[model samples]
Target: MLDPSVAAVRRAVRVALSRVAEGGTALVALSGGADSLALAAATAFEARKRGIRVASVTVDHGLQTGSAAVAARAADQARALGIDDAEVVRVEVTGAGGPEAAARDARYAALRAAAAARGAAAVLLGHTLDDQAETVLLGLARGAGGTSLAGMPPSRDDGGVAWARPLLGVRRAVTHAACAAQGLEPWHDPHNAEDRFSRVRVRERVLPVLEAELGPGIAEALARTAEQLREDAEAFAEMIDETIEDIVEPAEAGIAVSVAALAANPVALRHRVIRYVVDSEFGVALTRAQTLEVARLVTDWSGQGPIDLPGCTAARRGALIVFTARA
Candidate 1:
């Protein structure tokens, strides 16, 4: 009999695998961690059942000693678990946005390259519910808007490959249980236990404390919040797309929005309109403070000078709020 945790993970992977074309490989990003190992196991089973090939890629960030060994072992485990095509790609992590963000960017690039080389139809990630909850908490802590708090999407298309996170509904503990149920030994990264990383602290300390004080299921609540926010963001996107076409006009090295149209809309839509205009024309996102300042050009109607934002500046020119490129 399959363990319940394993079965749950398998079910999720089956849905993800359904997106892959028949005769094409579905590449699993295996790190030998419990989440990824369980993912690889499930992909192997489910892909085979659907007459699809399963492959695995283990990324070595080269951060710690014996990292290559870890990567090699992960690939070996992939082969042992009925994944005949297993490979390891080593990446140099540039500490650009600190270490975590840089490593993730490099890892994903490496995985995309590997998947393309392997002719895989899509790449599978193992980010689970706990990860989503932590992401939302971090976004909220940073005072990010709805889209940031929306957390990770279940699937996204990058360049050409479709990236899917099938385990977004699965809990971290369940991945561990799934690996154990399948007699798979998982590698525990020491970085995960380190207190220095914000995510590690959230996982080890913040979330546990929250759960204890607020009762259990706080993680689930956070994940749900992210899902709901994502839905709201999607709707806002549709509205913005429909609305931007009418109220915006091309200006001198910039874009202009009708101040009358913006001020007449509801506050929520007004704010979104300002943001969407700046984002579309300038290729930059406005902070809430900046957005509010931009809105003042419409609502307050004071004769103010140009308000500088990231990569652009906003100014009130009669009935138009013009956003122009920063000199």
Candidate 2:
């Protein structure tokens, strides 16, 4: 009999791989952790049945001691799982936004490069339902609004590379169980226990407390909330695309939106249009307050001076709200 945990993971991987072309390659991001290791093994099994080539990439951020050795062991595990081509890519983690953010940026860049080099149809990630719950909870705590609360999408395309997360519906414990069932030893990263990282705090402290006090299904409930919000976001995105074409036009430096058009929609759609326009034009996100201030130009037309944004400025000029790049 197939282990139920293994079956659950394999089923998820099989469904995610359906979009990949037969005989094309898929790359799994293997960190040697239970979640990623289980994903790698399942991908190897499922992709073989579908005539899809499978490989694994273990990113070494070199943050912890002996990180290279850990990456090498992960690669070896990938090979043992019948993944023929396993590569370890060492990345220089440097940038703003602290160590965790920097490491993540470097790791993603390496994964994208690996996928591009191999012309892989998809890159598989191991973020599970628990991760989704943690993300939503963090977003809520930060008051980051709907976009952050929407959590991670199951699939997205970045620079022509398809990134897929199949286990977003599976629990984290299931991955650990799957690894044990298959005699796979997952490397437990020490960073996971350290509460210095916000995610670690959420995982180690916040979630357990919520589960104990709020009952046993807090994580599942949060995951479901994320799924629903993501659905609404998709619908709004389509609406923004349609509405933006009719109301937005080129300005002197950035872009201009129709004031009357902005005023015509409900507050929800209006705020979305305001945010979508600025983001699409200037490549910067606006806060809810910033967005409201922008919307006020249409709602409370008081001939106010230009509102300064991160990379641009917004002001009303007759029928149009003009957004211009800051010099």
Candidate 3:
């Protein structure tokens, strides 16, 4: 018999699975952590009961010395949980960034590829409330806009694969409890305890201080803040879309936004509108300063001049400000 907590997780997974399109398979990304292991176990149990098949994939990011062994262990656990098709994917991390970030990028890329191979309708991840809270805090520290402060979404589209986080509402402790109840021994990643990682620093040092000074429910509060910010960001994006429809015009070079129309909207909406225009035309996200500079070109510039942005270029063309990639 499944314990009450395990039953609750199963219920959550069932609800998440039910929301997937009909006749589509679900792929669970098993990392062997307590949260992801519990997610796989609950998802497998619920999927079998519903007569739906579930596939598991573990990404072996060759970073730590024991990563391959950990990935193998995760695959073994998935098979033990009755997952028929368990596969371990090997991916190499490259580029100039933090090792954790590079590994995450490679891992997600591998998962998307595996999902495509498995014909999965969506990829399920195990991002718990604590992870969400930590993300919110990290974004806050960066002092970015509301969108940055908004943590991971419960469901989002990535490379044509719907990514869903069924465990977002669950606490990490609850997942650990579920693992214990199921007699599963989850592997603990040493990197999580290393203070060198920014996320771990926030999770261990900063969050504890906040909880001590503010209250015990600080994490929950931050998670709630992220949820609220996400809603607000969505609505703001919708407004930006509407503004774009009203103000955007096509030019010989690229898309143009009417300076007069842009100036009519409030500053916040105007900044977002510029970002929307740049991203839609060039497939790039602009920094706050870049967006502001583009807005200035539209509102304050007197003549035509080029403004360079990452993977894009914005210029004031007569009464319209155009954004496009440099040739």
Best by lDDT: 2
Candidate 1: worst 10 consecutive residues by lDDT? Answer: 274-283
lDDT of 2 by residue, 1-327 (tens): 999999999999999999999989999999999999999999999998999999899999999999999999999999998998999999999999899899999999999999999999999999999999999989999899787899999999987778999999999999999999999999999999888889999998999999999899999999999989999999988988877889989989889999899999989999998988889889989999999999999999887999999999999999999999999
Error of 2 at 227 (Å): 0.6
Candidate 2: residue 32 lDDT (0-100) = 97
Candidate 3 lDDT score relative to the true structure = 0.87
Highest TM-score against the true fold, candidate: 2
Sort the candidates on lDDT, descending order: 2, 1, 3
Alpha carbon lDDT of residue 317, candidate 1?
91
Candidate 2: segments with Cα more than 4 A from true spot? none
Q: Rank the candidates by TM-score, best first.
A: 2, 1, 3
Off by over 4 Å in 1: none
lDDT score for candidate 2 against the true structure: 0.94
Off by over 4 Å in 3: 21-23, 302-305
Q: Is candidate 2 or candidate 3 better by lDDT?
A: 2
Tens digits of per-residue lDDT for model 1, 1-327 = 879999999999999999898898899999999999999999999988899998899999999999999999999999998998999998999867788899999998899888888888889999999999999999999999998999999988877778999999999999999998989999999999888988888998999999999999999999999999999988988988888889999999999999999988988889988888777777888899999999998998769899999999889998899888988
Model 3: per-residue lDDT, tens digit, 1-327?
Answer: 768779878877988888666556889999999999999999888887666778999998888898999999999999999997889999989866777778888988898888988778888999999999999988888877899888999999877778999988888989999999999999999989999889999999999999999889999999899999999999998888666677887876678889898889889888888887777788888889888888888678877478998777888877778777677
